[model samples]
Target: MTFLGVFAWSPVSSATVTTTLGVDPGAWNVWRNRRLTPAPLSRTWFRRASGSPLVYQVSDVLVWLATKRGEHIDPLTTWRLSLARDFGTETSDPVEIRRLAVLYARAVGPVIGGVRFTTAGFQAYLASLLSSS
Candidate 1:
Protein backbone atom coordinates (compact mmCIF):
# COMPACT_ATOMS: atom_id res chain seq x y z
CA MET A 1 0.00 0.00 0.00
CA THR A 2 1.31 3.43 -0.95
CA PHE A 3 0.29 6.96 -1.81
CA LEU A 4 1.64 10.22 -3.20
CA GLY A 5 4.20 8.14 -5.11
CA VAL A 6 5.92 7.51 -1.80
CA PHE A 7 6.33 3.88 -0.80
CA ALA A 8 4.83 2.66 2.43
CA TRP A 9 4.05 -0.69 3.92
CA SER A 10 0.38 0.26 4.08
CA PRO A 11 -1.88 3.11 3.29
CA VAL A 12 -1.75 5.86 5.89
CA SER A 13 -4.71 7.55 7.43
CA SER A 14 -4.75 10.86 5.61
CA ALA A 15 -4.94 13.03 8.69
CA THR A 16 -2.39 11.12 10.73
CA VAL A 17 0.23 9.61 8.51
CA THR A 18 3.01 11.98 7.57
CA THR A 19 5.77 9.67 6.54
CA THR A 20 5.56 7.95 3.20
CA LEU A 21 8.69 5.93 3.02
CA GLY A 22 8.79 2.61 4.81
CA VAL A 23 11.71 2.76 7.16
CA ASP A 24 13.25 0.05 9.26
CA PRO A 25 11.31 -0.50 12.47
CA GLY A 26 14.35 -0.20 14.69
CA ALA A 27 14.95 3.44 13.89
CA TRP A 28 11.29 4.40 13.73
CA ASN A 29 10.69 2.76 17.09
CA VAL A 30 13.50 4.76 18.55
CA TRP A 31 12.08 7.84 16.89
CA ARG A 32 8.65 7.07 18.33
CA ASN A 33 10.09 6.67 21.80
CA ARG A 34 11.68 10.06 21.59
CA ARG A 35 8.70 11.60 19.93
CA LEU A 36 6.32 10.45 22.64
CA THR A 37 8.72 10.95 25.51
CA PRO A 38 8.78 14.22 27.37
CA ALA A 39 11.61 16.57 26.55
CA PRO A 40 14.83 15.34 28.04
CA LEU A 41 13.84 11.91 26.89
CA SER A 42 16.68 9.95 28.43
CA ARG A 43 20.12 11.53 27.98
CA THR A 44 22.58 8.81 28.86
CA TRP A 45 23.36 6.38 26.03
CA PHE A 46 22.58 8.61 23.07
CA ARG A 47 24.90 11.38 24.25
CA ARG A 48 28.02 9.83 22.76
CA ALA A 49 26.30 9.01 19.49
CA SER A 50 25.02 12.56 19.21
CA GLY A 51 26.43 14.99 16.71
CA SER A 52 26.67 18.76 16.57
CA PRO A 53 23.59 20.98 16.42
CA LEU A 54 21.65 20.19 13.28
CA VAL A 55 22.97 22.06 10.27
CA TYR A 56 19.66 23.47 9.05
CA GLN A 57 20.95 25.60 6.20
CA VAL A 58 23.56 23.41 4.58
CA SER A 59 21.06 20.99 3.06
CA ASP A 60 18.79 21.84 0.18
CA VAL A 61 16.17 19.83 2.05
CA LEU A 62 16.11 22.37 4.84
CA VAL A 63 15.32 25.12 2.39
CA TRP A 64 12.35 23.17 1.13
CA LEU A 65 11.07 22.73 4.68
CA ALA A 66 11.21 26.46 5.17
CA THR A 67 8.63 26.68 2.40
CA LYS A 68 6.42 23.91 3.72
CA ARG A 69 3.52 24.62 6.01
CA GLY A 70 1.60 22.21 8.20
CA GLU A 71 -0.61 22.16 11.24
CA HIS A 72 1.70 23.25 14.03
CA ILE A 73 3.57 20.30 15.48
CA ASP A 74 4.17 19.57 19.13
CA PRO A 75 7.89 20.04 19.76
CA LEU A 76 8.61 16.32 19.65
CA THR A 77 6.54 15.81 16.57
CA THR A 78 8.01 18.92 15.05
CA TRP A 79 11.40 17.64 16.03
CA ARG A 80 10.60 14.22 14.57
CA LEU A 81 9.65 15.61 11.22
CA SER A 82 12.63 17.88 11.22
CA LEU A 83 14.96 15.01 12.00
CA ALA A 84 13.56 12.89 9.19
CA ARG A 85 13.88 15.83 6.87
CA ASP A 86 17.56 15.99 7.63
CA PHE A 87 18.62 12.41 8.34
CA GLY A 88 15.74 10.07 7.49
CA THR A 89 16.07 9.95 3.71
CA GLU A 90 14.67 10.84 0.32
CA THR A 91 14.02 8.93 -2.82
CA SER A 92 17.45 8.95 -4.48
CA ASP A 93 16.17 10.58 -7.62
CA PRO A 94 15.06 14.14 -7.54
CA VAL A 95 17.45 16.70 -6.13
CA GLU A 96 14.64 18.54 -4.39
CA ILE A 97 13.47 15.71 -2.11
CA ARG A 98 17.02 14.82 -1.17
CA ARG A 99 17.75 18.35 -0.18
CA LEU A 100 14.59 18.66 1.92
CA ALA A 101 15.31 15.44 3.76
CA VAL A 102 18.71 16.67 4.86
CA LEU A 103 17.37 19.86 6.37
CA TYR A 104 14.66 18.02 8.27
CA ALA A 105 17.01 15.53 9.82
CA ARG A 106 19.29 18.26 11.05
CA ALA A 107 16.40 19.96 12.80
CA VAL A 108 15.17 16.79 14.42
CA GLY A 109 18.13 14.49 15.26
CA PRO A 110 19.01 16.11 18.55
CA VAL A 111 15.69 15.78 20.31
CA ILE A 112 15.04 12.39 18.81
CA GLY A 113 18.48 11.02 19.58
CA GLY A 114 20.34 13.40 21.82
CA VAL A 115 18.01 15.23 24.20
CA ARG A 116 15.38 14.14 26.64
CA PHE A 117 11.91 15.44 25.85
CA THR A 118 9.22 16.16 28.44
CA THR A 119 5.47 16.68 27.99
CA ALA A 120 5.97 20.40 28.28
CA GLY A 121 8.65 20.34 25.64
CA PHE A 122 6.29 18.35 23.45
CA GLN A 123 3.65 21.06 23.69
CA ALA A 124 6.17 23.74 22.84
CA TYR A 125 7.36 21.82 19.83
CA LEU A 126 3.79 21.34 18.69
CA ALA A 127 3.05 24.98 19.08
CA SER A 128 5.90 25.65 16.72
CA LEU A 129 4.91 22.98 14.25
CA LEU A 130 1.45 24.43 13.92
CA SER A 131 2.39 27.74 12.43
CA SER A 132 0.53 30.71 13.78
CA SER A 133 0.47 31.54 10.10
Candidate 2:
Protein backbone atom coordinates (compact mmCIF):
# COMPACT_ATOMS: atom_id res chain seq x y z
CA MET A 1 0.00 0.00 0.00
CA THR A 2 3.06 2.18 -0.23
CA PHE A 3 3.20 5.15 -2.55
CA LEU A 4 6.02 7.15 -4.08
CA GLY A 5 7.50 8.21 -0.78
CA VAL A 6 4.90 7.09 1.72
CA PHE A 7 4.21 3.88 3.52
CA ALA A 8 0.81 2.24 3.26
CA TRP A 9 0.61 2.06 7.00
CA SER A 10 -2.58 1.82 8.98
CA PRO A 11 -3.26 3.96 12.01
CA VAL A 12 -0.32 3.22 14.24
CA SER A 13 -1.32 5.74 16.90
CA SER A 14 -3.68 7.34 14.38
CA ALA A 15 -1.37 7.37 11.40
CA THR A 16 -3.63 7.92 8.38
CA VAL A 17 -3.97 8.04 4.61
CA THR A 18 -6.21 10.34 2.63
CA THR A 19 -7.42 11.34 -0.86
CA THR A 20 -10.28 13.23 -2.58
CA LEU A 21 -8.72 16.35 -1.35
CA GLY A 22 -9.18 20.08 -1.51
CA VAL A 23 -8.28 22.65 1.06
CA ASP A 24 -8.27 21.49 4.68
CA PRO A 25 -11.93 20.47 4.21
CA GLY A 26 -12.44 20.13 7.93
CA ALA A 27 -11.08 16.63 8.51
CA TRP A 28 -12.87 13.97 6.47
CA ASN A 29 -16.31 15.54 6.66
CA VAL A 30 -16.46 15.94 2.92
CA TRP A 31 -18.73 13.99 0.60
CA ARG A 32 -16.00 11.61 -0.42
CA ASN A 33 -15.41 10.65 3.16
CA ARG A 34 -19.09 10.26 3.88
CA ARG A 35 -19.45 8.02 0.88
CA LEU A 36 -16.31 6.12 1.89
CA THR A 37 -14.61 6.25 -1.47
CA PRO A 38 -13.22 2.86 -2.42
CA ALA A 39 -10.61 4.05 -4.81
CA PRO A 40 -8.70 5.70 -2.00
CA LEU A 41 -8.23 4.63 1.59
CA SER A 42 -9.30 6.92 4.43
CA ARG A 43 -8.23 7.39 7.99
CA THR A 44 -8.21 9.93 10.79
CA TRP A 45 -6.37 13.19 10.38
CA PHE A 46 -3.03 13.65 12.12
CA ARG A 47 -3.82 17.07 13.45
CA ARG A 48 -0.62 18.88 12.68
CA ALA A 49 -2.01 21.97 14.34
CA SER A 50 -2.97 20.27 17.57
CA GLY A 51 -0.45 17.47 17.27
CA SER A 52 -3.18 14.92 17.81
CA PRO A 53 -5.33 12.52 15.86
CA LEU A 54 -8.83 13.44 14.78
CA VAL A 55 -11.46 10.96 13.72
CA TYR A 56 -12.56 11.36 10.12
CA GLN A 57 -12.27 9.99 6.62
CA VAL A 58 -9.84 12.25 4.89
CA SER A 59 -7.12 12.53 2.36
CA ASP A 60 -4.69 13.53 5.06
CA VAL A 61 -1.90 12.28 2.93
CA LEU A 62 1.61 12.27 4.37
CA VAL A 63 4.94 12.45 2.58
CA TRP A 64 7.77 10.80 4.50
CA LEU A 65 11.29 11.90 3.55
CA ALA A 66 12.82 8.95 5.43
CA THR A 67 15.36 9.07 8.26
CA LYS A 68 17.51 6.14 7.24
CA ARG A 69 21.27 6.07 7.42
CA GLY A 70 23.81 5.91 4.60
CA GLU A 71 22.97 2.19 4.51
CA HIS A 72 20.02 1.90 6.81
CA ILE A 73 16.36 2.80 7.03
CA ASP A 74 13.94 2.79 9.88
CA PRO A 75 10.36 3.34 8.64
CA LEU A 76 9.94 6.34 6.40
CA THR A 77 12.89 6.53 4.01
CA THR A 78 12.32 3.03 2.69
CA TRP A 79 9.04 4.19 1.31
CA ARG A 80 10.21 7.62 0.22
CA LEU A 81 13.07 6.31 -1.87
CA SER A 82 11.06 3.36 -3.16
CA LEU A 83 10.98 2.28 -6.80
CA ALA A 84 13.73 0.97 -9.02
CA ARG A 85 15.04 4.37 -10.00
CA ASP A 86 14.75 5.52 -6.44
CA PHE A 87 17.19 2.66 -5.89
CA GLY A 88 20.71 3.72 -6.66
CA THR A 89 22.51 2.07 -9.55
CA GLU A 90 25.76 1.30 -7.81
CA THR A 91 26.18 -2.45 -8.00
CA SER A 92 24.15 -5.52 -8.83
CA ASP A 93 25.14 -7.07 -5.52
CA PRO A 94 21.95 -8.58 -4.16
CA VAL A 95 22.49 -7.06 -0.76
CA GLU A 96 23.34 -3.64 -2.09
CA ILE A 97 20.45 -3.71 -4.51
CA ARG A 98 18.09 -4.85 -1.82
CA ARG A 99 19.27 -2.14 0.47
CA LEU A 100 18.65 0.40 -2.24
CA ALA A 101 15.22 -1.05 -2.87
CA VAL A 102 14.36 -0.76 0.78
CA LEU A 103 15.73 2.75 0.83
CA TYR A 104 13.66 3.57 -2.20
CA ALA A 105 10.54 2.35 -0.46
CA ARG A 106 11.44 4.31 2.62
CA ALA A 107 12.26 7.57 0.87
CA VAL A 108 9.20 7.58 -1.34
CA GLY A 109 5.80 6.09 -0.76
CA PRO A 110 2.83 6.05 -3.05
CA VAL A 111 3.16 9.76 -3.63
CA ILE A 112 2.88 8.92 -7.27
CA GLY A 113 1.68 5.29 -7.09
CA GLY A 114 3.81 3.47 -9.61
CA VAL A 115 4.11 6.72 -11.48
CA ARG A 116 7.69 7.84 -12.02
CA PHE A 117 9.13 10.93 -10.37
CA THR A 118 7.34 13.38 -12.63
CA THR A 119 6.66 16.13 -10.13
CA ALA A 120 8.70 18.97 -8.73
CA GLY A 121 7.42 18.33 -5.23
CA PHE A 122 9.72 15.36 -4.48
CA GLN A 123 12.81 17.07 -5.82
CA ALA A 124 11.92 20.26 -4.03
CA TYR A 125 11.46 18.42 -0.76
CA LEU A 126 14.85 16.77 -1.10
CA ALA A 127 16.49 20.07 -1.93
CA SER A 128 14.99 21.65 1.13
CA LEU A 129 16.41 18.95 3.38
CA LEU A 130 19.83 19.14 1.74
CA SER A 131 19.91 22.89 2.13
CA SER A 132 19.11 22.55 5.78
CA SER A 133 21.97 20.10 6.23
Candidate 3:
Protein backbone atom coordinates (compact mmCIF):
# COMPACT_ATOMS: atom_id res chain seq x y z
CA MET A 1 0.00 0.00 0.00
CA THR A 2 1.05 3.61 -0.58
CA PHE A 3 2.05 5.77 2.31
CA LEU A 4 0.82 9.28 2.99
CA GLY A 5 3.02 11.90 1.44
CA VAL A 6 5.89 13.20 3.55
CA PHE A 7 7.44 16.60 3.15
CA ALA A 8 10.98 17.57 3.99
CA TRP A 9 12.51 20.98 3.69
CA SER A 10 16.13 21.99 3.59
CA PRO A 11 17.72 25.42 3.69
CA VAL A 12 18.39 25.20 -0.01
CA SER A 13 15.87 22.69 -1.28
CA SER A 14 12.86 20.55 -0.39
CA ALA A 15 11.66 17.10 -1.40
CA THR A 16 8.70 14.88 -0.85
CA VAL A 17 9.10 11.22 0.04
CA THR A 18 6.32 8.89 -0.88
CA THR A 19 6.81 5.22 -0.20
CA THR A 20 4.79 2.27 -1.37
CA LEU A 21 5.12 -0.91 0.62
CA GLY A 22 4.20 -4.14 -1.10
CA VAL A 23 5.90 -7.18 -2.53
CA ASP A 24 5.98 -7.64 -6.25
CA PRO A 25 5.06 -11.26 -6.93
CA GLY A 26 7.82 -12.00 -9.41
CA ALA A 27 10.54 -10.14 -7.57
CA TRP A 28 9.44 -11.58 -4.26
CA ASN A 29 9.51 -15.09 -5.67
CA VAL A 30 13.02 -14.68 -6.96
CA TRP A 31 14.20 -13.06 -3.77
CA ARG A 32 12.52 -15.69 -1.58
CA ASN A 33 14.08 -18.60 -3.44
CA ARG A 34 17.51 -17.06 -3.62
CA ARG A 35 17.62 -15.86 -0.04
CA LEU A 36 15.48 -18.38 1.83
CA THR A 37 16.82 -21.57 0.25
CA PRO A 38 18.89 -23.31 2.87
CA ALA A 39 22.05 -25.26 2.20
CA PRO A 40 21.29 -28.94 1.79
CA LEU A 41 22.86 -29.89 5.11
CA SER A 42 22.35 -26.63 6.99
CA ARG A 43 18.65 -26.04 7.15
CA THR A 44 18.73 -25.86 10.92
CA TRP A 45 21.70 -23.53 10.84
CA PHE A 46 19.90 -21.21 8.47
CA ARG A 47 16.74 -21.15 10.53
CA ARG A 48 18.65 -20.53 13.72
CA ALA A 49 20.85 -17.83 12.24
CA SER A 50 18.34 -15.80 10.29
CA GLY A 51 14.69 -14.78 10.08
CA SER A 52 14.58 -15.27 6.29
CA PRO A 53 12.43 -18.34 6.65
CA LEU A 54 9.87 -16.45 8.66
CA VAL A 55 9.90 -13.53 6.26
CA TYR A 56 9.54 -15.80 3.26
CA GLN A 57 6.74 -17.82 4.81
CA VAL A 58 4.86 -14.75 5.97
CA SER A 59 5.25 -13.08 2.61
CA ASP A 60 3.64 -16.08 0.95
CA VAL A 61 0.79 -16.06 3.43
CA LEU A 62 0.31 -12.32 3.00
CA VAL A 63 0.18 -12.73 -0.73
CA TRP A 64 -2.41 -15.44 -0.39
CA LEU A 65 -4.46 -13.40 2.02
CA ALA A 66 -4.35 -10.39 -0.25
CA THR A 67 -5.42 -12.41 -3.26
CA LYS A 68 -8.20 -14.20 -1.45
CA ARG A 69 -9.50 -11.03 0.08
CA GLY A 70 -8.92 -9.05 -3.12
CA GLU A 71 -7.21 -6.24 -1.25
CA HIS A 72 -3.80 -5.30 -0.01
CA ILE A 73 -3.01 -6.39 3.52
CA ASP A 74 -1.56 -3.56 5.60
CA PRO A 75 2.06 -3.62 6.66
CA LEU A 76 1.10 -3.85 10.32
CA THR A 77 -0.51 -7.26 9.93
CA THR A 78 2.37 -8.39 7.79
CA TRP A 79 4.85 -7.32 10.46
CA ARG A 80 2.76 -8.88 13.23
CA LEU A 81 2.65 -12.30 11.59
CA SER A 82 6.32 -12.23 10.77
CA LEU A 83 7.16 -11.24 14.32
CA ALA A 84 4.90 -13.89 15.82
CA ARG A 85 6.37 -16.64 13.67
CA ASP A 86 9.90 -15.55 14.39
CA PHE A 87 9.37 -15.08 18.10
CA GLY A 88 6.89 -17.93 18.70
CA THR A 89 4.78 -17.65 21.87
CA GLU A 90 7.14 -15.40 23.75
CA THR A 91 5.16 -12.29 22.77
CA SER A 92 1.46 -12.91 23.38
CA ASP A 93 -0.03 -9.58 24.39
CA PRO A 94 -2.19 -8.37 21.54
CA VAL A 95 -1.80 -4.68 22.34
CA GLU A 96 1.95 -4.83 22.79
CA ILE A 97 2.37 -6.98 19.73
CA ARG A 98 0.48 -4.53 17.57
CA ARG A 99 2.40 -1.61 18.98
CA LEU A 100 5.65 -3.35 18.20
CA ALA A 101 4.47 -4.15 14.70
CA VAL A 102 3.48 -0.56 14.07
CA LEU A 103 6.84 0.60 15.36
CA TYR A 104 8.60 -1.81 13.04
CA ALA A 105 6.65 -0.65 9.99
CA ARG A 106 7.35 2.96 10.82
CA ALA A 107 11.06 2.39 11.35
CA VAL A 108 11.65 0.15 8.36
CA GLY A 109 9.22 1.57 5.83
CA PRO A 110 11.60 4.14 4.44
CA VAL A 111 14.47 1.71 4.17
CA ILE A 112 12.36 -0.78 2.20
CA GLY A 113 10.51 1.64 -0.03
CA GLY A 114 9.55 0.79 -3.61
CA VAL A 115 10.22 -2.62 -5.21
CA ARG A 116 13.74 -3.39 -4.13
CA PHE A 117 14.64 -6.65 -2.41
CA THR A 118 17.82 -7.87 -0.78
CA THR A 119 18.83 -10.44 1.82
CA ALA A 120 20.61 -7.86 3.92
CA GLY A 121 17.61 -5.54 3.62
CA PHE A 122 15.29 -8.26 4.83
CA GLN A 123 17.59 -9.07 7.73
CA ALA A 124 17.75 -5.41 8.72
CA TYR A 125 13.99 -5.23 8.53
CA LEU A 126 13.70 -8.21 10.86
CA ALA A 127 16.23 -6.64 13.20
CA SER A 128 14.16 -3.48 13.42
CA LEU A 129 11.03 -5.49 14.14
CA LEU A 130 12.70 -7.64 16.76
CA SER A 131 14.35 -4.74 18.53
CA SER A 132 11.19 -2.70 18.91
CA SER A 133 9.09 -2.83 22.12
Q: What tens-digit string does per-residue lDDT give for candidate 2 at 1-133?
A: 2432332221222223333223244554463467532223222112232444333211123322121113433323332333233334435344443444444433554243322222453443333233221
lDDT (0 to 1) per candidate: 0.31, 0.32, 0.37
Clashes per candidate, residues 3 or more apart or on different chains: 32, 29, 0
List model 3 lDDT by residue over 72-98, tens digit each: 654345545556554453465656665
Tell me the TM-score of each prediction against the true structure.
Answer: 0.21, 0.22, 0.27
- TM-score order of candidates, best first? 3, 2, 1
Candidate 1: what lDDT? 0.31
| Candidate 1: tens digits of C-alpha lDDT, residues 1-133 | 1133221111112111223324454554465467531122222222232332121111122222333444333323333343355348434333344344334433443344223334554344333333311
- Give the best candidate by lDDT: 3
Residue ranges of candidate 3 with Cα displaced over 4 Å: 1-79, 87-89, 113-133
| Candidate 2: residue 51 Cα off by (Å) | 8.0
| Candidate 2 displacement at residue 103 in angstroms | 9.6
Q: Give the local distance difference test score of model 2.
A: 0.32
